[model samples]
Target: MSKPVILCVDDERIVLDSLRTQLAAAFGDAYIYEGAEDAEEALDLINDLNEEGISVILIISDWLMPGIRGDELLIQIHKNYPNVIKILLTGQADEVAIDRAQKQANLHRCLSKPWSEAHLLETIKSGLSKL
Candidate 1:
């Protein structure tokens, strides 16, 4: 079977770098981590990967970004890629935003900022297991 592809979106380069490093150590070559500064760029990467016959199985996106909120992006992705698991990594989780994420993105879970590494890994493992 092909390795599961995981696309992670975060505006902070530091966060992205750290996530890539950690995910690489945990998942090895079985996962692909694509960290983008914005949702638009992530969408572009998704299209490119799709063309290459790479199907992304999971997405971990921040709720707040410079362009295109995470909920909005996930909504678009859900419209097209309904099978992909959507997760939220964000500091802001208001009731309204949570509602929107649930209704539009079908968010699997929302992990807060300053997440513990063990927790992150465990959550990701659970997300992948569902596939």
Candidate 2:
């Protein structure tokens, strides 16, 4: 069977690279990582993945991006891909944003910035299991 796919969105390239490496190491070939600098690109990739019959089972996104806030991006994702688990990784999310995202996207969890590698891997595993 094909491996599960995870879509990770962050404006910082370093964060994206780190996540790709770490997730690959932890999961081996069990995940397909789709990284994007902004929500628009992520949306495009999600569409392509859906067309290819590969649904994104999880999304890990940052909140303070340039084009779209992480919560907004996840909300959009929920609109089309409601079953995909959504997570917000940010250091600056306010209570209002969190509340809105929780209602709109059913946000699974929020991880603070500079998250521990172990915690991240564990959270991802749990999120995927719940899906």
Best by the lDDT measure: 2
Q: Which ten contiguous residues of candidate 1 have the minimum total lDDT?
A: 1-10
Residues 5-93 of candidate 1 have per-residue lDDT tens digits of 78889899998898889899998887778888899998998888888888999988988989799888999998888888998888986
Model 2 spans with C-alpha error above 4 angstroms = none
Clashes of each: 0, 0
Model 1 CA lDDT for position 42:
87
Question: What lDDT does model 1 reach?
Answer: 0.86
User: Residue-wise lDDT of candidate 2 within 1-131, one digit each (tens)?
Assistant: 55668989999999999989999899888788889999999999999888888879999999999988999999999999899999899999998998899999999889999999999989988888886
Candidate 1 has which clashing residue pairs, if any? none
Q: List the residue pairs that clash in candidate 2.
A: none
